[model samples]
Target: MPDLAAVADLEARLGRPLTPDEQARAGALLADASALVRDFTRQEITPVTGDTLVLRPVGVLLRLPQRPVTAVTSVSAVGPTGSVLGALSGWSWDGRDKVDLSCVSPAGSWPLSWTGPLPDTYQVIYDHGRATVPPGIVAVVCAMVLRTLLSPSMTAGMVAERIGAYNYQLQQGTGAAGASVVMTSADEKALARYGPRRFGTIALEAG
Candidate 1:
C-alpha cells in the first residue's frame, strides 16, 4: 500500500486523536515512510537528481539580487473556497526570495501569489492550535511535502533531521503567528517553477 494510505490506516487503527507530542512523532514517521516509497517507485529511473526536478520562480523581479533565467509556468493557491487570487508565468528575483505561508491570514495582500528565490531547504509553518490538526496528520503532510521537493538520493532520515530542526524553529516562535504548518523550499529554483498553490488555505475572522 502507499505510504499515505498506510498512514491513514494507522490513524484509523489508533482510534484516537493525537496530542502535540504524538503529532510530532507521527509526522517524523510519515516523512520517513513517504521518502522510502518515492525511492522504491523511482528505482528504475536514472535516480532522482537536482537537474531531474524542475524548479520555477515567481514573485517580483526587481527584488531579485541577480537576474534569473527561468520562468514561472504555473501559480496556484489551495484554500477551502478554491479561488485563484494571483497568476504568473515567471518572476525576477530580488533580495527577498522567500515564500511565506505561515499563518492563516485574510485573503489578498497576504501574498496569496508571489515568489522570489528558493531556499537551500524546506521550511514548515505550524500554527498554534493543535486542536483541529492532530500531530499525526501534520507529520504525514509535512513528510509528503518534503519528499515532493527533495531529490531521490536524499534519505528519509535526512528529511526527519531537517524536520527536527524545523520543529525547533516552531518552538522558538520565530515563525509566523498561528501557523500550524508552513513550508519554504530550500531550492530557489523549485519556487520559480511551481508557484505557491494552496491545497487548503484556512481563513479566520475576528468576531
Candidate 2:
C-alpha cells in the first residue's frame, strides 16, 4: 500500500524544502499516518484488482468488505473439497460493495437445485476501491503526520485542551522522540464514511 501523503506533500505544507534528515523522518511518519488512516477507515484506500474472497452467504445479499467495487470478475460455487464446482450466473453487483444472488429457493435463500450436497461456500474475485485517494483523507493524513513530525517528543502534562473538539495538546520538549501518534474525534468523524456501512444503508459510488 502507498502512503496517502507523499514527502513532497509534506514539504508543500511546510512551505520550505525539507532537510535530508527531515525528509527521512517525514517519510516514516507519513507511512505510519497512512497506515493509521487505513486502520481508521477499515477499507482499502487505493484501487485493487484480482481481490478474492470466500463466503457463505446467508440471505439474498452478500456484502463485500471493501468499498466502491468496480467489477466482479467471477463468482463460483465451491465443493466440499474446496474445488470449483461451477460458475454461478444469477447474481448482480450493487455498484458499491454488495453482491445480490437474486431470488430465494427451497434449498435456501440462494436459488440452487441439487439432490447431492449443496454448495456451502462461494469464491468471488473482484476489483474495488478508489481510482485516486480522496482529498479529505489525504489532508487528514498529512495533518496527522505534520503534527507528529513537528512535535516528535512530549513532556508529561497536557499543554492545552479544547473542550468542544474533545482534544488535548501534549507538551513537547527534549524528553523523548517518536511519541505515539493518535487520531482526534474530528479525524474519526471525517473518516466515518470509509468504514463499514451499517445495515439498511447503501453507499453509492460515482462511476
Per-candidate TM equals 0.20, 0.74
Choose the strongest candidate by TM-score.
2
lDDT of 2 by residue, 86-176 (tens): 6777678878777887642232333344457546666778898888889889888877766666652443223444668586555544322
Worst 10 residues of 2 by lDDT: 103-112
lDDT of each: 0.30, 0.70
Residue 44 CA displacement from its true place in model 1, Å: 12
RMSD of each: 20.0, 8.1
Question: Measured by TM-score, how close is model 1 to the native structure?
Answer: 0.20
